[model samples]
Target: MTAKPARDPRDYSWLPADIQAFIARTEAAYPADAVTFSIQQQRAFYDRLCADFDPPHPPGVTTEDLTLAGVPCRRYTPTAPRSGVTAIYFHGGGFVVGGLHSHDAICAELAEGAQVVLIAVDYRLAPEHTHPAAYDDCAAVVDSVPGAKVLIGDSAGGTLAAAVSATRGETAQIAGQVLIYAALGGDPSLPSYTRHAFAPMLTRADVEFYGTVRYAGGVAPVGDVTATPLAADSYEGLPPTAIFSAEADPIASDSVEYAARLAEAGVPVEMTEEPGLVHGYLRARHMSEGARASFRRITSALAALAAQAVAQ
Candidate 1:
């Protein structure tokens, strides 16, 4: 069974032209099979997208290479350093697709909007890298980034961000996390999961397929908690969180459950469910009005958290 995508919010009529175009084009490229494609194929697909996507660079952002867990990562820094607060961004594509290049536009926008350095990791994807490989790489990068930092990612990257928070010891220093449309688990009972089962881009089967590849040889963690941050036994000690969920996305429950857990743990958290948006709407920033709103919400949350961290 597949859940139907929610209709476009009535307000999308006021969205920027580029965002609207992005929605049309991306929607045309239906069924992003993140779980089914091989790493090579996925890489090629995104590479092509990057090649075609030429987003205007923010005034002073520069890109650099850094070593995390001994794996090479790409970092984007602002020309003007704002303070100690940093955003280590992970690109989403399940546990498989997406790279620094594909995410360059959004990262640059984030850097510009939040007025903070954005370190984007080019983590290895599965089924080649598999389970903990991606997680380990992310943890290493977070640990290595100098100064107080906020972890951020959309979709699969969002899942890893939460996982890293969970696995970090008392000494690991992430100040906050921003999860956008994260996958909390493989369970299909979540309302959004059942509602958007056949969502144009991401579907129920697509998630299952990705899970199989993500855990191919590794021992599957019991239930969604540990495997899914929402499923984690406790949210205590994890940094404050900001969740951005799309009303039409199947993974909406991930953010909702995570927000509830964070609150229960007495951890500070805020959640925003964008009406009528679909999965991966961040990439449609240029075409969809919803994407721009989503981006603004993301940066605003980061700025608010960064301010709190500064005050402390």
Candidate 2:
């Protein structure tokens, strides 16, 4: 008898049932061709989709919106906040849509879990403020803080977290970083891009689109470490990092490569890939077991990093 052929990992059948349900629920509220629409329309679509997944913010977390170094930010303070440490979080909307409100629950939960103050950045988006603009905003917030910081972000925000890690880690005395499915300047032609190009939530095409919008005149700056951390000549001196990636996402390889580079630079790093998950799984935390586990890892990592800061 002939042996059954190996299943194609690219097929949706390879995704766990819970993840599939998450995809269905997410896409149900978000237009499948949302990327094809006007930026304003796309933002509205994304806002509605995020609202549909709303879970209550962790109890006993107090928040306030303020401007740090002229950049809008939301600060979450836990009931039992730890002194001498703070986590700066950047929300992910491909750097065009997400803002403080979009990630309110996530920030609150993270602050409560880590028992530290967490500041969620509301950086300027693209086509209006490109590339270094957002980086500068995030960095200004980092500079505004008095001591070492915990830099954290997902997707585009993850890219910013790393950029900040390289640019401000030393001056800010950055304690650590926690990146979720970050698009750390990896090769787009890699196998993950080809295999998961059409993966749920985010596609390779979407990644390319965001890149174009992120830069000025669709041209990326040459050798700008603040724009793309991976483009930096050196990864040395970066703070300890924890990266969580989705196995089925086209950008998963970015996390892998970033971790390897960090280790090579002698920077302590930990990377975890959640099998059968896709990009933007952070919003699926309440729906998928894999996502929930990843979220827990994120919170735990933040707590550990804050502890490290306190120890020093």
Candidate 3:
């Protein structure tokens, strides 16, 4: 179970100094069991964190809240005109955390970077909303969004984004997908799972804990291939995918295996590994150099997709 090659840590040196300070303060505040903390506590912590980041305006982007099939969604539209390519993004927080405010910065940046409308879905959380609830909420938004679409999310949100895209299959009007540091299910023996089991941010135990809370009262459906998009029964016609994982994270291997499966299914897929970066880097964009670099990659990928749309 040898680890795979990943981007070097030095690449993140470009991150703002204030962001680095914010990350240090945050680490001292919240650690591995962040989900176990009360919602109010988490919200307070997040609010402060967001306060620390430089408020980059979403140039050419307008935001609005709308209801689709009774589900509420916040949409970020880039000022640029295009062929109606929109992205429905979900935030990562182990299904038990995260919301509109928690991921506001990344969503805004992605919307502006990719030059596409970004619809951030606020799916119901777990221990209250439970399994299938969050995923369904996101899928419904995908089905409801007008015109072509791209599905994107980080961590648990990434899992849900992939699940929704996979479940909708080929005919669903989706354009592509971008999953960042997602936690796809995989065999425990995988290299990253064992080698980086206790990686700084995410751990196998943390994953197990999230799953337990998410499926607490449900039928506890067996971990089907579809439930775990990486292990999906099929990936044909599901659009190209970009998966980003960090070398210092435990779940990096799962994303690798998922990309391979997609490739085998003939799906166009690109996988990037960031070295010395831990899980949840996307949310810490203000602090971690790896996080900022990853965001840049996200913007570049989305912009590339926008360019291809133009050529077509």
Candidate 4:
């Protein structure tokens, strides 16, 4: 085989100083070479990396782990009265690694920030549980949550949230959707995909690998809304949506296209691109200025969604 080209050192000068330090700490903890390891090893490394940046759960937020509709879940309830709305969260792990515990701190902070009840689903992972399994688990929990709700997800979880919001039947009441650096499927030849094919944190090759594992058997049908929301025939009447994309992520175009489709279909939508950020920046919310700003935007969106649900 021909020798692989030497990879250039990623430029972090454009990112905030704090973010650069955060990235350095993360790299030291979980080397990029770890990506070549087995799934189990990757999962373990990911878990540790997440733990390293986990801030203490916000005060006044209580958590309980339970099974909802046969799907394992963790619920975060703030001390204040709920706005009669729920935020169903799916953790991102490329549908292979993350679980309830992996994203516990995130859920806790979100619940506190949004001042609403948050439910984090621990759906089955891949290579063992395939496509419809994780989606099914997420759908079940979304259906089980009481009253009007908003769907929130990141990466694979973002894909699940979008799928659930788009494919749910007429009766399901989704107030809005918050997609943070979501991985909605789209044409691989998109400009962002090609431009950021080898971006730091998440690369095009990494995304392709996850997609293969997510649908190990075979790819879903072209127009299957649940499998690929971007391919949905109509984005009309879905829900108000707020999509956040990292400037340097290969899948960033997925969010851009999805937002455009939603807007074209007359759905209220807002898209924000965080500059000098990469995939998985959510963990740096406490340390990085860009990540913190993104988190604030997410909190504002969730709060607005909850208010809208209450008004309805």
Best by lDDT: 2
Clashing pairs for predicted structure model 3, backbone only:
60-79
lDDT of 2 by residue, 45-85 (tens): 88898788878888788889899999999999999998998
TM-score of 3: 0.86
Q: What are the per-model C-alpha RMSD values against the true structure?
A: 4.5, 1.4, 4.8, 4.2
Error of 2 at 28 (Å): 1.5
By lDDT rank, best first, the candidates go 2, 4, 1, 3
State how far residue 309 of model 4 sits from its true place (Å).
0.8
What TM-score would each prediction reach against the true structure?
A: 0.87, 0.96, 0.86, 0.94
Clash count per candidate? 12, 0, 1, 0
Model 3 off-target regions past 4 Å? Answer: 1-23, 36-56, 218-220, 223-226, 309-312
The runs of at least 3 residues in candidate 2 whose Cα sits more than 4 Å from the true structure, single-residue gaps closed, are 1-10
lDDT of each: 0.76, 0.88, 0.74, 0.86
- Select the stronger candidate by lDDT from 1 and 4: 4
**In candidate 1, where is summed lDDT lowest over 10 consecutive residues?**
8-17
Candidate 1 lDDT over residue span 1-312, tens digit each: 899976653334443455446655764443255345656766676666656554877877887877776867777777665787888888888787777777887888788788788888888788788777788888888887777888898889998888888877346768888988888773578787876776655777777776777875645667544356656666788898899988766778878877887888898899899876777788776656777778899989987777676666
Report the lDDT tens digits of candidate 4 across residue range 1-312. 999975453554666687778778887767666667898898888888888978789888999989999999998998784667899999998888988878899899989988999999999998789888899999988888778989999999999999999888345788899999998888898888877887777888888888787776646557777777887888888999999999988999999999999889999999999998888899888888889999999989898988888898
Q: Assess the local accuracy of residue 196 in candidate 1 as a C-alpha lDDT between 0 and 100.
A: 75
Model 3 per-residue lDDT tens digits across residues 1-312: 988977453343433454445446666656545666776676566566555543766666678988886787888877774666777888888787667777877888888777777888998888688777888888878888777777888898888878887788555677788889887777678887767765555677777777677775634467554356656666777778888998767788888998888899898899999766777677666556767788899888877765564455
Lowest lDDT sum, 10 consecutive residues, model 3, at 7-16
Distance from true location, Cα of 190 in model 2, Å:
2.1
